[model samples]
Target chain A: MHFMTALKAAWRQRDSLLCVGLDPDPAKLPAHLAGQPEAIFEFCREIVDATADLACCFKPQIAYFAAQRAEDQLEALIEHIHRRHPEVPVILDAKRGDIGSTAEQYAIEAFERYGADAITVSPYMGRDSVEPYFAYPDKGVILLCRTSNAGGSDLQFLDVGGPAGQERLFERVARLVAEEWNTGGNCGLVVGATFPDEIARVRQLTGDLPLLVPGIGAQGGDIEATVKAGCSADGSGLMISSSRAILYASRGEDFAEAARRVATATRDAINVHRPT
Target chain B: MHFMTALKAAWRQRDSLLCVGLDPDPAKLPAHLAGQPEAIFEFCREIVDATADLACCFKPQIAYFAAQRAEDQLEALIEHIHRRHPEVPVILDAKRGDIGSTAEQYAIEAFERYGADAITVSPYMGRDSVEPYFAYPDKGVILLCRTSNAGGSDLQFLDVGGPAGQERLFERVARLVAEEWNTGGNCGLVVGATFPDEIARVRQLTGDLPLLVPGIGAQGGDIEATVKAGCSADGSGLMISSSRAILYASRGEDFAEAARRVATATRDAINVHRPT
Candidate 1:
């Protein structure tokens, strides 16, 4: 199925807009799973099994895995999750961006190497650096806009010359991407839940384009305001993601259950504010 | 040696500011060495050996090697080149940028995995994304400012608010990075050769910060003008780079020799215009 359709189905079945991020830090993993790749895999599998009913999708931050030299194992783990929960979408939060030709190779890696339903990208290098990812008919490309971190406003909120003489860079990017790059409705924007006003503004600019709202959990972003600001007019296009908060919900044997509890709370909170 | 000192030494020894980029395309490699990773290694070794005396530094665009699933071979190639000619620095042209924690992992990859003397980075993610790279005192971080590409102006030249009210985003980044991020002198700016005015402006803003100027040879940038615009006041701190035009000088048996010839010519051209 296409990414959008699959996303829609996930939302309907789970009744949630939450995308649980599986950023398994070895140091934060349960003591039994600390160093063993198999333990890590089993831990993630259990978490997936426990929270599959609550999350619309799963976003595995690739850096945490790549940093551990567990890239191959992470790929296998993601494949396992996809195979087990065929209805749930998997977004690879890689944030990769490079020159035109290089981006194509990354596209192959994100889409072919791991079979990701969606991938996050950095928009620092402009359109050519991003267009290659769109070549995949089934994958969604989530471009970083207003990130949740404190320093994010330093660059994303810059002013740029536009049809109206001046406009915020992220707003301009949102408009241009929505109009020019959304050829297949597979393009999305990442607007951190921390910036509700900007989120509302970007939502207006992007029309029906899906917004991946990160920063809700560990980043101190408000879930209710984010859901109200990010959900599309028809109530579907927001992938509210939480990583550290859910992944390390408990540092003990009950970690997977703790994860399910957090995912359930986040999912229920979003459902309360999800546009009708 | 400090990055600036090494750059100055390279400039003085070769009497040239040329830094040839060693971006080997598998399809464009000599037919005699086709389809073999060993052949790719051999080709890179020959080119480095032949041109070591002429070029100031060798920049291996990581993407070209990564595209072929030959990144390990490329790492071996870099180690081989560095061992053969220890004076010539290897700048890994990977424009990597991520959050602070992730950037630390990338720093380990670039400095430890490949032992790159310098690495290029995109500044779109702001200060925290780049600070971790500076933790290693010996290595250098070259921030991407105005690029040589046609579409680079699309965002790099946007107006970001600064102490000067409104300035080109690249110029603002140059000033901010030089003042705030260059405390250890390990930070540099990537100002493309294609834009002489921007290069000059950035050079002035950056002061003594080393500039890695790409887009010289096959990209059609003017070498003499770029050197004049990019060089520090002391006639140093510039690593003018060219990739495709140097590495793929010929697609035949004498490809390495042809690469050396073109590199020598580029070096000679830069020598003619160096400030006394």
Candidate 2:
């Protein structure tokens, strides 16, 4: 199935909009898993197993694994997720951007090597950097629109020429992604949950296209506001991501159980404001 | 040594501004070393040995290694570059951008794990994304400004707020990067060899800060115009990068020798425009 189609089905089947981020930090690993062989993969696999039922998707940030020379383990973890939870789609959050064949290589890395259902890309390099990824018809491409960081305002808020105050760089990105880049209907935008107003604006600009709304957990995004500002006409479409809070819920042995409890609460909280 | 200091030294010592890009594609690899165990590393090592003296720095685009599941080869290649040819700095052409710990992880991946002297980054995420890398006082961060791709004009040339023609998105990025992001002076920008006018504009905005100019050979960039527009006041601050033309110069055993011939000619061509 196409990533978007699979994502929508997963949202319905899982009854959640939460995207559990698997950014395994060795420094924060549980005592039992610390210093063990393939701890990065083990910790993440357990977290995936625990929260797979509560999540619409899983986002594995590639930098975490690549930093430790654990690309092999990353491959294993993604395979494990696919085998254990066939319904959940995985978003490999590498935020990659390049031109021509380089972008093709990265697409191959995400879809072929790691087997991610969808991947996030930085659109700063323009259309060519993104078009190469669209070659994968079944995969989804999420462009960073308004990121969940304070420094995002540095350039994303610059008034790139458009109607009065309506065409900041982020909004321009949203419009472009909706109008031009989504030709295959497999493209999406990343509107951070911290900026609910921007999220609402992005949703207004791009109809029911899926928005990967990252923030919420340790990033302090208001879940209720995020749900109301986001969500499609059908009261779905946003993959609300939470990482540190759920992953390291307890530094002790029952970390996976604690993760499930947190994921359950977060998924329930989002549903309260979801209106469906 | 600081990356800028090392690059300036490399420019003077090597008497060249060329940055040979190692974008090794399996389909493009030579017949003699096509399916060998470490073909990527072996090919890149040969190219580095052949062209190391003629070039100031070497750029290995990570996607090439990661796509073929040859990241270990990539690690080995960078190590070999440092060990064999200690004079030439290595630029990890990953173009990575993220925020907070995620950004830090990428920094570790480039500077610590892979051991690159410098790395390219996308400035779309603003300060926070680039700041993590700056934490390493020795390494360098080169932000994407005006890219070489034709699609770069898609968003880069949009009229972002500023003095009339001086505020296109790319120009705005140049101004912001020059004004604020270089606080520690460990920063630079990537202005493509394709657009010499924008390269001149970026040079004007960012005084003597180095520019990593890609797109000279296979991308059809004009080398004379690139050198004329991109040179620092001292006429030796740009790292003009060429990939396919130099890497796959020949598809036979003479590939390494042909690569050196191209490197020598390209380097001499750039030096003809150098002031001193």
Which candidate has the highest TM-score of all? 2
lDDT (10s digit) by residue, model 1, range B102-189: 6787787688878889888888778888888889888888988887876677678777666778798888788889888788888888
TM-score of chain A of 1: 0.97
- In Å, residue A41's CA in model 1 sits off its true spot by 4.4
Question: Tens-digit lDDT track for model 2 on A71-107?
Answer: 9999999999999998899999999999877999999
Whole-model lDDT, model 2:
0.92
lDDT per residue as tens, model 2, B1-276: 788888989999988999999999999999999879989899999999999999999999999999999989999999999999988899999999998889999999999999999999999998987899989988989999999998899888988768764378888888888898889887889998989999999999889989999989989899999999989988888999998999999999999999999999999898888777
Per-prediction DockQ? 0.48, 0.86
Model 1 pairs whose backbones collide: none
Interface RMSD of each: 2.1, 0.7
The local lDDT score (0 to 100) that residue A175 gets in candidate 1 is 85
What's the DockQ of model 1?
A: 0.48
- Lowest summed lDDT across 10 adjacent residues in model 2 chain A is found at A158-167
lDDT string, candidate 1, A1-276, tens digits: 788889999988878889988877777888877767476677778888989888888988776665555566667878987888999999988887776767887887788877898988877777878888989988999888887776776777778768888788788778868988788788888888989998999999988788888888777899889978888887878999888888888989899989989888888888888767
Off by over 4 Å in 1: A37-43, A161-166, B37-42, B161-166
User: Which regions in candidate 2 have their CA more than 4 angstroms from the true location?
Assistant: A163-166, B163-166
Candidate 2 all-Cα RMSD: 1.0
